[model samples]
Target: MTTMTDTSPREFKMPDVGEGLTEAEILKWYVQPGDTVTDGQVVCEVETAKAAVELPIPYDGVVRALHFPEGTTVDVGTSIIAVDVASGAAPAPASEAASASASAEKAAPATPAAPAAKPAPAAKKIEGRKPVLVGYGVAESSTKRRPRKGVPATAAPAEDTLYAAAAIQAVQGELNGHGHAPGGQRPLAKPPVRKLAKDLGVDLATITPSGPDGVITREDVHAAVAPPKAPEPVVEAPSAPAAPAVAPAPVASYDGARETRIPVKGVRKATAAAMVGSAFTAPHVTEFVTVDVTRTMKLVEELKQDRELAGLRVNPLLLIAKALLVAIKRHPDINASWDEAAQEIVVKHYVNLGIAAATPRGLIVPNIKDAHAKTLPQLAESLGELVSTAKEGRTSPAAMQGGTVTITNVGVFGIDTGTPILNPGESAILAVGSIKLQPWVHKGKVKARQVTTLALSFDHRLVDGELGSKVLADVAAILEQPKRLITWA
Candidate 1:
């Protein structure tokens, strides 16, 4: 191993892959300490609330340390890894080294006095440039410090060492109820920890920090919020010899043998929140119709043999999606969202068609942009790419936003029908049931034909019963008569 004498490590902060996302959980790390990395080499994969994204190192260097382990959710803009950019560089002059040692000793005293230490400095501003992922230009938010009494508007870089020392001392003072003076330095903690403390009404100044570098953690906040245990009763000794004390039962038992606990994070956590919000906020009205889609099924087979769509995916869903798009065109008011704040209804002229896909991580609804503009062949190609990318867990965050309507195909799993909920910010969702051969009257004769059930759920706040029914009836009519796709278009 080569030793560097005076080189400083470069810190690579976690980038916000999804705009406005506050934190991401690290899924895996590709490189470790002492591993050499080059520019644009992926070092880790992280999952934000929206999707999983791979982060690459911006410059070539040897990794010095990883700040957090896998599964830890870190705030955006926090340094996750440090790299020795100038490894094997020449040592500093003796005079410079001596001066550096003196400065270090002065800045970080053996016993820190919180009253004398200064606040840590704000991040340096790079004029005309914003913080970004390695290649993608992403927005970087300014660091948010907890509200303190007497912190200065700004601080110098030289105060960083003193701040660290003061933070360590503050942790000890927290136990003694003398953490920060009325106008002294603030306690050290991560953004999430601070938020948790705020939410639980716990004071950070009173909790002892257990994290490295004297930083407060989520567990510290929780411990502070919990009530202190009652002191055990002190029983008087009996005249006779005391009997053997019974061992207490285990306080908690791990049922690893019968049940496994999986942490809900990343995509799954976001999906749960969204689902709950959508369910409670929207008054959903569902309309169902069972249609004989024999002609649509026949057309799907015929499209599979067409030379123009030779490489594309042609399935019943493709036709059903087309029918829905046509139905929206006929009843444009159904393609709308209720703006609660504005007290208005937003009717969209364009269509962003979302398809609910189930992945190993969780269920995700990625949509096609401008679906109304795409032809049949183009739509098929887009659907093919969407399914392939979702299965590989590489769907981008942009592909999942701005959806005006959604389709959930429960038929794939042999479900007959389901009342689907609207995606948040969307007005309608169509659920397709399994298509099977059933006895039907064709030209006054009973015959076996392909039939399926379609259920359309809409936000009743803006979509009245009549409007919802018209859209559902239109979709069923088009599916039953496959030629309506061309006629309606």
Candidate 2:
């Protein structure tokens, strides 16, 4: 338990984890009320619009309370938790939560008994928090305070300011989330609650808070805004003839158990939006080419044994990526983004090669930065790391941002070629189908050779049929000859 004389709690406000992300939905809470928390400990995981991130508490203390529950979409800089840091209170156990709240309530004074006890309540009001950064301080807001009700109908700004300053001595106590309290105490509500009150023009100070302790809740705000509707006045009509009720139409039915409704959000949401835009805005033209890659498969096995590439991931994908890079080098026009506003085709000098990765979350295309400059071994290392990070769901937003081209290996799913949509802002995407042994003529003799279908989709607005065919043909030719990579690259 905290020192009996010092019952004040410190607040931990949500920090901006991403670039100007206004809000995030709290996915889970690691600590509950009265649970001891140390500085830099992960207290909660939040899923922002960009990605999921774990938030760490900045100071050691007993967790007095969690302000917002899990799944709550909290605004940046709002207090999400409160900690009691009185001396010897570092390790408060969960069982002590009720007793802790009772003590906090007892410590709270009904009114400003001393003439000196007054000032707007804030997280920064605690003296121990001076050593901490201001980012976690009470987030300042632009909303103007609704005038105090008891004040005279005239604006006596100077006199009111002077009188309040002379009486101010910042009240020290844990915040009661339930908003029902005396006029001296300001109503506590989450950002969304505050917004609701503002939109409905409901005065939070006037509503009796029904939330825990004394904080105002969404339901309380809503109740204040909209009360139960009064029943319609009963009008008894004398001797009215009743018409026969029409038979209800048979209700349509289906097996609810057989269907699943997964909410579209996060990576899936972004991919859907991009795909729709790319498909409709840019007319896609896909060309398919089946090639004999018997030599390429043999070369992949040989390179795996080479000392230079021993530790690297060598596969058909690795060689395919290299082949595409060589093809792009030969035809730089294909590696470009169309700038509609500028009314120009912006050709890129460098390639950020994107490899489509399928994670449990959704399909994500994280690109290998400056892929064109990397040697075969270096490219393999990057590709391996990208795949691993994506699988672990630890890929950062930056890794997926910029891209000039992409490759989707449908072969892993044992599927043949697909007309892959161009990743938005890029002109082309290469789809590699499953490679299988097939009958082919080698040196005027029929024999079984490794074969696969390759599909290259390009924005017809930028790439004509002739340019598209050459890029596809070049990639196929290099895969078939394997030795051509040395001469061409």
Candidate 3:
């Protein structure tokens, strides 16, 4: 109920927690209004399209207000919390009496074009600071927030007006087309909306965005698809007799006893969109191979006993991953991405090997950087860390980007194998089946051997049958002859 006139408060805007992520759902608040917080203390956890991230308050202060409650999906750069750091100085007794008697308009502060800029002294504090989020766009700490010209000092501050201001500016820009910021960037729209516009053959630059902040929306896209027509013919039909009313069907409640509807959002929604885009956009061709990996299994066990890798993870997945990397090295052309815009096949020189990990929230594929260059021990360490981080739901968005190839170990769930859709922007995905003891001829005699099935799916536009087969065959060959890892690698 108290308003501070002595100091301007600081606002913690929602950071772009991932690459180009537009919005995030606030899941929980660790600190409420009136709670004291120190620098780097986590204040909230938000679920973005990629993952849930805990945002740490960057300075010491007492929280003035929580702008939005939990579960609000707020756009990035919007102030979500307000904090005051006037060295613990309480509001003056006279100011308190005035605040009590003051009208709402008199207490309301002027809205800054941006955040209440952080003081310049904290610059060195974050100078060497590495990003806590992997691949997330961190909001820059500002040294100044230019107040709109002619606003009086006595005017109160608007702590929660980030989205609203952007919207007003965006609308103005839309009305006056070609209104670009100092640095001319295109209008704002979600990736899917852009994709939809592309699919519908609609030009986004030509359309006037009706969404908040002049962002293009799906409805706007569909509207663009429909042909414009002159006002509908005004026909006054003779009054007709009303028909007898019929009984209507009762709609089922989402919260019914047996049925529950979960809102499509966060990682699952992103995964779905990516899957759909991959499936329809790219011509997917899946190939399968059943192999006896008894030797590979034995090698895995042997690696576990080795002194160097004693504490690291040693499993079929480790060997499978190594085998795939070796295969990619042999058939380098198979490791590529199809760039639709450039109309070129981008063959990557290095491998960002993605390991698809299933978590409580959703499935995430975090990759190991320069995996092709890693030795067996180094690869094992990275793989172990990737799995642990993914399972704990702490995997960074950066770890999932720029993957040239991916591996989904569906065998862990006891499934034989699956034709996994390619991860968006990647050429292929390999699915590993369950390693089981099955009857097979290993030395020209029927005997029990560790057998498994692998499914490789590739973008048909880039990978021809011969090339895809070579990659799959090489992976199988390495697993069939585990010693080949030494010879081939």
lDDT of each: 0.72, 0.70, 0.72
How many clashes show up in model 2? 9
lDDT of 2 by residue, 1-489 (tens): 244544678776776555555777776676789888654345675665555655656446788889998768888878898988655433222223334444545676452232122223222233222211111332233012232443221211222232122111111112112222374444665433554665577777788877675567778878876756642222223443333233356665544366667766555666788899999999999999999999999999999998988777889999999999999999999999889999999999999999999875678898999999999999999999889777655566667878999999999999878989999999999999999988999899999999999999999999999999999999999999989899999
Clashes of each: 0, 9, 4
List ranges where model 3 is wrong by over 4 Å. Answer: 1-10, 31-41, 58-65, 83-256
Better of 2 and 3 by lDDT: 3
Native-to-model Cα distance after best TM-score fit, residue 42 in candidate 3, in Å:
4.0
lDDT of 3 by residue, 1-489 (tens): 554354778777887767788999886676788988665445775777776655666556799999999878899989999988655332122233234334443555444322223233344443533333223222353212343334323222232332223222221121111112233334445434544665577766667789886666778889978876632332223352233133346666753567766888898888899899889999999999999999898888888999989789988889999999999999898889988899999999999999998876788888999999998889999999999877645566777888889999999889998989999989999999999999998778999999999999999999999999999999999999999998998
Per-residue lDDT of 1-489 in model 1, one digit per residue for the tens?
222255677777877666578899986676799988654445775668776555656445789999999889999889999988653221222233345444544776563333233222222221223312211222223222332223322212221232222222222122111123134333555433444565577766777778775667778889888777532232234543334334456565553356667888888889989989999999988989999999999999999999999999999999999999999999999888889999999999999999999975679999999999999999999999999877655576678889999999999999999999889999999999999999999889999999999999999899999999999999999999989888888
Error of 3 at 103 (Å): 31
Q: For residue 33, what is the lDDT in candidate 2? A: 95
- Candidate 2 Cα lDDT to native: 0.70
Clashes of 1: 0
TM-score on alpha carbons, each prediction: 0.64, 0.61, 0.64
